[model samples]
Target: MDTLLANITYAGGAVYIFYILTAIWIIAKKNLKLLSIIFPILALLEGLFIDWRWGRIQDYGENAQIVLGALPSFIISIGLPFIGFYIHHFITQNLPKDPMIDSLIEKSKSGAFGNDDYPSIYSLLESKIFEKSSYQKAIQNVENQKELINKMIAVLTDKKDDWDWKFNMFNEYKVVFTLYGTGGSYDPDNGTITLLTNKSGGFMNYKNPANTIIHEITHMGMEYSLVRKYNLPHGLKERLVDTLVYLMFKEDLPDYRIQQMGDPKINDDLKSANDLESLNSIVSKFVNK
Candidate 1:
């Protein structure tokens, strides 16, 4: 029984040590500085507890002749820090933030109808005349929306060489106007951009519909390349998309400056400009090299 107990204690110590080492490795690889400090301490405490339990089991009687069974405990002691670090690192990495839609809301809020250029876009949307029949009017509305979207895409592509390259990658890319749902979404799998015309305060709510269109198309582009290239986390990817929107359309649609400011992921520690510049430098380096 004593031999079995000592083996069990040694095995427990080994498990803790293994976990601690794994955590340390992940933390160091990811450059998680805060976790690096916390994990080691946690591993230490766990190792001590295992040792204490082993000692108690032995102290129960005279058959506890394992007086110098301290080597395993000592080894576990070395691993405690790594365990603590791994826990911290795992928690921070996996903690859920606001949904992807919430990030989109933050990015699109300033441009929504009644906000920036919505009134003008709404007026343009209303200007088109169609047959009085409901079905015919809906069909005409869709056609007019497509014409307008094409015009905007043309302007954007003409202005930026990068836009042409990105937009042309998906040959069958089409924008469909929907009566409900989000401001816009790009489905790379289908090469479609769905624009919400109603439900979220209506399609007219977007201040710069052109900017929204461009932003969504940018997603289609980045979805193919940067996402795969960087292995960017969801939050970071949304921030990068926002940064791209800002960089591409800031001069054309100054209202996008508000959208840039509203990104929840932006912080004093992680400036959007710096992130944008870093990504741009990386892309430029890759292309030039």
Candidate 2:
């Protein structure tokens, strides 16, 4: 039926418009100048073609007419997404700018996650790179082992049944992977662990990311509570995570190589399993020392 065909075409056009807008926003955020210009032009041309084709559908009922009858429909669908590109140009070319803002716009264009200079987990995991290829396959392993990984973290951290509650986690924990970065990075707010998927002589055995997941999840539990509370430096935080993980999961995760990344000064004080029982108070005692 022409009516049904028109309906389907209309829906498809709506989806295409939504997708282009989302893409334009990303291009703007990522500061891809060429793509910003190209995408909107492409979207506009495609939208016009689609509108013309839809007009060809015979007996396209009153509903289609109301939506697609006027040139305004084409403008609304194609013009909105292009706004981000214009706004980006305005900010960079016309407005007062600083080094920090410039750095954010330019450095973000790299979109590469480096181990030492890691960005937010949101940026890394939300990246399109891991959507396919070796990284995608490796991330799947992490997902499958996520439940067991969280349980291991709960036990080693001694929170067990009340782990989420104890950590004050508001969301169900998530696990994802990045092809680069530290063995793992934790986003406490999102309760996510992004593991590096380089299995070539790297820590996470890509076949099984359980050890890496447990390590980062352990960080999530402490990040807000103990790490922030003590104002522990990055080195100290890494050291503390490993200390707890090793103390609790040494046998279960024999393959896990403790990176020993943190303040060496406090090493002798945190080697005992008994230390896991009163971790917070002990950390406070040693940290203030």
TM-score of each: 0.37, 0.49
The residue-by-residue lDDT of candidate 2 on 52-167, one tens digit each, is: 55444444232111111111122122233345634543321112123432343344456642343223322332232223344434544544554566456445434533332244
Cα displacement (angstroms), candidate 2, residue 268, comes to 2.3
| Model 1, residue 68: C-alpha shift (Å) | 80
Please report the TM-score between candidate 1 and the true structure: 0.37
| Per-model RMSD to reference | 27.5, 17.9
Q: How many residue pairs clash in each candidate?
A: 15, 1
Displacement of the residue 188 alpha carbon in candidate 2, Å: 0.5
Give the least accurate 10-residue stretch of model 1, judged by summed lDDT. Answer: 63-72
Candidate 1 residue runs with Cα over 4 Å from true position: 1-168, 199-201, 258-289
